[model samples]
Target: MLYNLFNKVSSMNKFAALTKHFAAAVFWGCMMAVPGWAQSPGGTEKELIRLQNEWATARIKGDVAFLENLYAKEFRITAMNGSVVERDADIAVFASREMKPELITDEDMKVSLYGEVAVVTGRENLKGTYKGIPGEFALRFTNVFVRRDGHWQLVTHHSTEMRKK
Candidate 1:
């Protein structure tokens, strides 16, 4: 009778251990999946910022071709003066010799990611001129990004001057 009781208890212990091991395996499998999900959003955010930085550099370099790839189809832009520009026209504006060899930098940017869409809002400080006209200004700008075919592209931009009285 004592031997029978000992055997039952030992078997129960082994069963419990096996159950614990299976649970642990499942937990880790789930943990690994979380990263792939989280990475998509985080990676998109970082990529959005990187793309903006590259476009900014292209602007500074006056590289129209590089800048062309950065823009999206049907891209819409509103200038600080409230003028609307379409895709190719906007590219023309930038590629035109209006801007001197200058730099465009983004600051105080707040970026939001919504699935396939991202919005970047911030201050754009320009240090350049366009054909004797002051091309640079302290402006508030918002750039919209959309993810297409596994890539984020800039789709819309609006800038408003922050004038001091």
Candidate 2:
């Protein structure tokens, strides 16, 4: 019948309009997600900075346990003296009786985020003593951190002592 055909055609048109609206909603939702994803890196950068400071504080206080928790299991640091410092070695330094940090400060710290990895570069001015040898140095350092299990841990560190100008 003509009336039946008209009703069926109207229903089809209604279904098409609903589909269009649903598609539009999904499209806009995805568009909003992009910006949210982009903004997430900003939070990560701030967190990395905070972690950097905390690491420095732990070093100054000789908090070996804290450093152990923050560092990855395979963490390694190439020191300014060209010594490859592994996790256990560094923890030993923190636990040493002769080496004690008097002042540990960082400056000009910058962090770059690559997905779940963050690279931090900064200047560290340290005043300390190791084995009765004065440890006063200005160094530029790079620290690589990775996010795992919703926590950031330092994976690698390399530092070069900056010569006096």
Candidate 3:
């Protein structure tokens, strides 16, 4: 009878261990399935910051090729003037001389990440001309990027002109 009780107790302990492991496995599986639950590797934020800087440089230089690769096909921008510009149209304007950007500097940038998506918000100090009309302004901008095919691309951008106090 003692031997039988010992075997039964051992079996119960084994069962409890198995149950614990199974619960852990399930928890991990659920975590992996949920978006942004998994811990991201380091340097993602720095890479995104670099991308933001590159975007400003690309705009000033009218680097169409870089812009093409950076912007997703469905990308859209809500301009400071409240006009919505699609990817192709924006790229065209950048390629042409109509949208001249003498300088664009980003400041006080913040980046938020969610698994495959990231949002960047900052102020852009811009000095340039559009259609020979000189303009200088500060804009508060939000740029959304999505990781696609292992590369980040701008999916949406919205900017509002910052009015002087």
The per-prediction CA RMSD against the true structure, in angstroms, equals 5.6, 5.5, 4.0
lDDT tens digits, residues 44-145, model 2?
Answer: 778888998898888888888898899999999998889898998888888784678888888999998886788999999989889879879999999999
lDDT of each: 0.79, 0.87, 0.91
Q: Considering summed lDDT, which 10 consecutive residues are worst modelled in model 3?
A: 34-43
Q: Estimate, for each residue in 1-165, the C-alpha lDDT of model 3 and write its tens digit.
A: 966765777777979977999999999998788646225434788789999999999999999999999999999999988899999999999899789999999999998988889999999999999999999999999999999887899999999999999
TM-score ranking from best to worst?
A: 3, 2, 1
lDDT by residue for model 1 (1-165), tens: 966865777777868977999999999987786635345666666777788788888877778898677788878888888888898876776778666647688888778877568898888788887777665578898999887776677899999999966
TM-score of each: 0.72, 0.78, 0.79
Which of 1 and 2 is ahead in TM-score? Answer: 2
Q: Is candidate 2 or candidate 3 better by TM-score?
A: 3
Q: Give, for candidate 2, the lowest lDDT window spanning 10 residues.
A: 33-42
Q: How many clashes show up per model?
A: 1, 0, 0
Report the Cα lDDT for candidate 1.
0.79
